[model samples]
Target: MSVLDQTRVDRPSPRPRRLSWTVSDAAVMIDRGMRHTLRNGDALFMSVFLPIMLLLLFVYVFGGAIDVGTGYINYVVPGIILLCAGFGAATTAVGVTNDMTTGIIDRFRSLPIATWTVVLGHVVASMARNLFATGLVLGIAVAIGFRPTASPLDWVGAIAVVALFILMMTWVSVMFGLIAKTADAASGFTFFILFLPYVSSAFVPTDTMPAALHGFAEHQPITPIIETVRGLLMGTPIGNSWWIALLWCAAILLVVVPISSHLFRSRTRV
Candidate 1:
């Protein structure tokens, strides 16, 4: 064979594509998200600060007015935890919206990578941040007067519920991020999510609410999730609240994930 032909034969071929590449790409995006969080320390500071401030204000200012049979702090801590998680997840919308508007997403599209990796990265980072935020709130609650009778397994279950809830919310946030023209608009979508816990059994009992309000509060997604976390922590009978919460989370993911994916594609089309 000629020298040129021998050189061609010695050259390496391109590697075969594998499904596992998605995981690696997602990790890169996840790292990008973590770096963003670290660079903007204000994000972490605000995320933790708001929840802690709320915990203090509610436990001290309004604790006397709310009655939960047990200490009000203990009763409300679970709800506050959910609130913290929601707040963390809301940042995903802002991040996505900023990227969309700033052309970062367009740059990503030009790369040889799976589209879903970017979304997954945002979600994983958001979940990590939320878990940290919730843990901080729980620690503060414990420092005050909150106590729980939950076992190790119950604690695991509570964590799982919160994580799943965050995942569901992150997808919704992604959709809002894609649809929103401004960061403020994208964030506005989370107002209802942040408010939902209050209307539910988070702050006060549903029975204390008026008839129609009570019905609505009892049926809302936040109620079961809050109740499930509260029940798990308090060692109260969870009954079907955990299952109901899981179902709600699953349903939200089922509906919103596709819509978010579609919106992302439509909006990012070059």
Candidate 2:
């Protein structure tokens, strides 16, 4: 062998230094993202407006004649809350999709940031937005005479259950962001979400539909979720329905997290 070949064989291959960041790093990333989202007043307004308008339009306008079993607003509020959770998650897709379309995510990749934090940061921000929307909807529900007579602990449990659903849905949005070709397509994901509340017992009683349709709707994912949540609020027995809700949330998490992370790596490839 030549001298160069001998020297090449002798040189040691260097390993990349592993990065070890503190909890503060994740906290800082989350806080920065949260602030950016809160600063967008227009976005905040639209997020709050859709559900509020729907609540008003339905409860006062069409709700009078629609006997949903718990009166108008009382029956409608929980369904709207679930819809609100889905709506809030869609914003995550929109924001992330916008960034990907505009090369902002690529720019973030070049920065000295934890790349995993990029998506999680957006998720935390979306959670904050959903929290605001949930609060607003609950306020409207109470004002419209939708009193939830649950104990404080049960109320807190309801919030926690809803929060899990929000996170799960937000992760789905992030997956959409990774895969969507256009912003409009990203926004269109909301259509499927919107269809869910209607197909379930959000706006009306399932018994009002035909027997076959009622059977399907009652067993589908959203019905048990809405039932358990509304039941808790009404001081009625949540039964096995709450466990079913938790199962749905857990199942979504198990499936989506891995699939989304894989797609995320492929799309970013950094």
Candidate 3:
């Protein structure tokens, strides 16, 4: 062969461009997640079931006992939304753990796809699920007695806050899933996220708790988020809760995303 022909032959075919591969790979994985979600009736049911049941139980059964100013349903629905977000994000851990345990991550790693796309796909799907589940809970609240008094901008702010919380929790759950040895362990890891609201201003004001518990409840990450959402929806003074909540979400995401990505790489390495 001529020199130019030899040079062309020796120059390996250009590997496929990465950005396009990442997008397509992430899209495929997202579709996989969506299919998993759609086919799993139990998962979908559980996503909304716990939050609705708790909302009903609180509004009718325990609501009469708890003093949250006017209507207890209105007071607790925001927290319920957050709870639903937590539960939804927790499922990502289970899914990721399942993928890991099943060797799917290894298969993906073998492909010419961006490393982050695998986790990104899971994160995007989880965010959609959280939004849908939260919306369903919100609709049910409206059907019952919950009425939010926020303006258009306030609603926007509330949604942005919820989205940030969802993203933060999703990243954290991804880490949990990657680190977990089993699916059950992964699921169990999110128990604290689910229960964090109970110690916050979700059901009742933090002041009602005992002194030490009160301090913790007042200071935990969930309290400010719940308070910020409540204030936005109820037209109450938000104070600095919104800023604090944003910072918490940003910090969690900044810390968790990279760690989770690294853990995923380590756990999936051939």
Instruction: Give the winner by TM-score.
Output: 3
lDDT of 1 by residue, 34-104 (tens): 88776766557646778898899899999988877988888889988888888778878888888889978
Better of 2 and 3 by TM-score: 3
Q: Which stretches of candidate 3 lie over 4 Å from their true place?
A: 1-14
Instruction: By lDDT, rank the candidates, best first.
Output: 3, 1, 2
lDDT of 3: 0.85
Off by over 4 Å in 1: 1-21
User: How does model 3 score by TM-score?
Assistant: 0.91
lDDT of 2 by residue, 1-270 (tens): 556654435643454423555255568768876886787664565568888988898889989999855677877888889888888777778777776778777887775556677778888988988988999999988988888888998898889888988898898888887788787888788667778778888788888889988898898888888888888787656789899999998998898888878987877784
Single out the weakest 10-residue window by summed lDDT for candidate 2: 11-20
TM-score of 2: 0.86
Residue 121 displacement in candidate 1 (angstroms): 1.3
lDDT per prediction?
Answer: 0.84, 0.80, 0.85
- For each candidate, what TM-score against the reference? 0.90, 0.86, 0.91
